[model samples]
Target: NTFFQISDLEKKLEVEKEKTAEVSGDDDQEDKVSMVTLSGQEMSFESRGELEKAIKEMTSVVSKAVAAKEFRKADDTQKDVDALIKLREKLPSVFELEKQLKVMKQDMDKAIKAKKFALAEELHDDVEKLEMRLKTERALQPPPPKDLAGRDTHSVKSVPVVATVASAASVRSAATTPAKQPVLPKQPLEVSGPSSDKTVKHLRPSRPLSATEDESILSITQMLATKRGNAALLVGPTGGLAGILTDTDVTRRVVAKDIDPATTSVNEVMTPNPTCVTMGDSALDALSTMVE
Candidate 1:
């Protein structure tokens, strides 16, 4: 029985070889392929195997590009890799690095033009992004003269004209400005108990949300049900009301999407501070700001 099986395998190999020989030089013949399609509702990739393969391949591509000093290509491949990593809610650290590099480039351009060599030195020193070696090489090479510098032998204005304000407004102008006062009246603004025929307009955008207030979804929902409020006051890292969130925005970002509570980071949802407020505003001033 074993011998018969071996004989059959030999026969199969011979037949396959004959078929390959017969099909030789057939360029028009379509190559065999297997394709798999996926639904967004299902796994983003067709399977875990496919996803892993793609991740490893992208990483290898980027690594090779980096080794070869092809930094621009490496940066691009890094972006594609970062996008894939984000599908798992992982950080896109490389993307941030790319942004920093871009900002440094802009700063370098401005610094060179303005002759702010100190700033350019700072940017170059602080820039710890990929393609650093290549960029460093290019940076060491001096820039060409400006168009005007390269122009006619006889020039009307050989010397450049640059001017700057000697000084800003006087220190007294800032010192004499009055501080912001609180919005609370000498007496509390009265509201009818329980039953109200009319609603108070709370349109001022400066309302300070309390620090003691909970940051739960229940807290937010309850506020929306009772108040004609458009936004929630987000507390800052310093443990004070930081910024605000709005209902229309809530309807768009969270409530409508039903995003996973565990996976979704609210920091992205929360507003950042130094939020468009009048500087030196007091708590009462901030509240009165809302009432006004």
Candidate 2:
């Protein structure tokens, strides 16, 4: 009986050794393959099958582009890749907002169960505010127009402009300023509340102007007055959103400097790289952006 038990124990030890050997082999094979990233760092793909698949796809595409001598095709692919990366980066903010909203709702429910009506009301209001923000976040920006076959689409990236918090007086000035003589084009302004449809983009009251930066401040002032808008979207020579000229800008920067509006250029006084919300953002998001 003792000899039989010893044989069984030896057999079990041999099986354990085989399993460890197999695992080590897998580790050795995983360490053999690595990828050099754009940041000049070496990344191992031992367990990332998706990354390996993406690399294979990229390699195949490069070979095809080289064979066809179609460099523009490669450029277009790069643009698509960049867009995907940007979209991926944006998704986390929405998810985080949703998580917070869920927590708020849970707290509100607890308050109601405990007969704390006032606390429940406050939590409910907070939840509604976060919900609006989440709606705005979910609104995706309209994709850029597709590039022409052989032409790379160059996009204009807005530079961060220096902005100051507007005081109560500045806000009042903006509220009172009217676009002067000729009426400017007006965009739709939709303000949604708890009772209305929540899917609509909260378009704030503003006007888009194609006037050059060298445009007279007087003309901009009149345009704002004419359109009943306190702010004008200044367009660059390239027809892109160059800057925002507002009543606050005029009051603090131009009027305070004692510069004649007729002689001064709008570009010289306008706030460059103004904060803006996309079409899908809610009214709360717009308000938060302006406040920030």
Candidate 3:
């Protein structure tokens, strides 16, 4: 009878041990699940460092997609970026928690040495609470704004612009109407003298300013006056031409409206995505484009 009892007790003890192991495994799995999430799917990371590295890689991918003009892919990847950022925000400061734990341990040791058993015991309990709270505590900071592409505004380069002309209905009708009239001898009409034959390349390049810059409109005006320039090119974050801020734009958009130039940014008054022409194109062609 004693041997049978011992065998049964051993079996029950093994079962209890198995249950405890399963519970520990589940807790570890939960921690992993709470670490990071993307596209409604849970992602497991062993450490915060791994999670940060993933965020950087994914952000770079998104930027590349945007620069490639793959809007759909960029948009999809942006969702994952947002999710990772949110997860990062929820993570506690490991360094801060460890520092606090170290201090508490030292104080507890001092209490013990002084024969203050109650104080030592209280500090010990506080340290355990803090350790357990590490997994649940969150930093809860606001996420930074998303900047997928055009992060470098200083890499400005001039590219040859291709002229894209749109056919107007009025112009088409005028052409058709004049076709029925008797043709006259071609007369050479001079518009702007020798300048008419000159190409856009002969003109001076506009000063470049970043569209995201905090340069005030007044400051931009001062820059234009100092450089003797009529216009400034507003470059986007990607170093591509974004818009143009002309003296006329400031006069009409700012002065005429009684807007405060000192407080307003250049982008606020600048024209966005202005029509462009190639530097090799004739000045007359550029003039026609402006007139149209």
TM-score of decoy 2: 0.32
**Which residues of candidate 2, in runs, are more than 4 Å off?**
1-210
lDDT of each candidate versus the true structure: 0.46, 0.55, 0.60
Residue-wise C-alpha lDDT for candidate 3, range 70-167, written one tens digit per residue:
98888878677655645543443344466688899999999999999999999999899778655444332112222212222211221211111112
For 61-99, candidate 1 gives per-residue lDDT tens digits of 766797789998888776665455344332212223355
Q: How many backbone clashes can be found in candidate 2?
A: 7
Looking at candidate 3, what is the lDDT of residue 119?
A: 100
| Model 3, residue pairs in steric clash | 150-237, 150-238
For model 2, the local distance difference test gives 0.55
Cα lDDT for residue 101, model 1?
74
Two-way lDDT contest, 2 vs 3, winner: 3
lDDT, ranked from best to worst: 3, 2, 1
The candidate scoring highest on lDDT is 3
Residue 100 of model 3 has an lDDT of 80
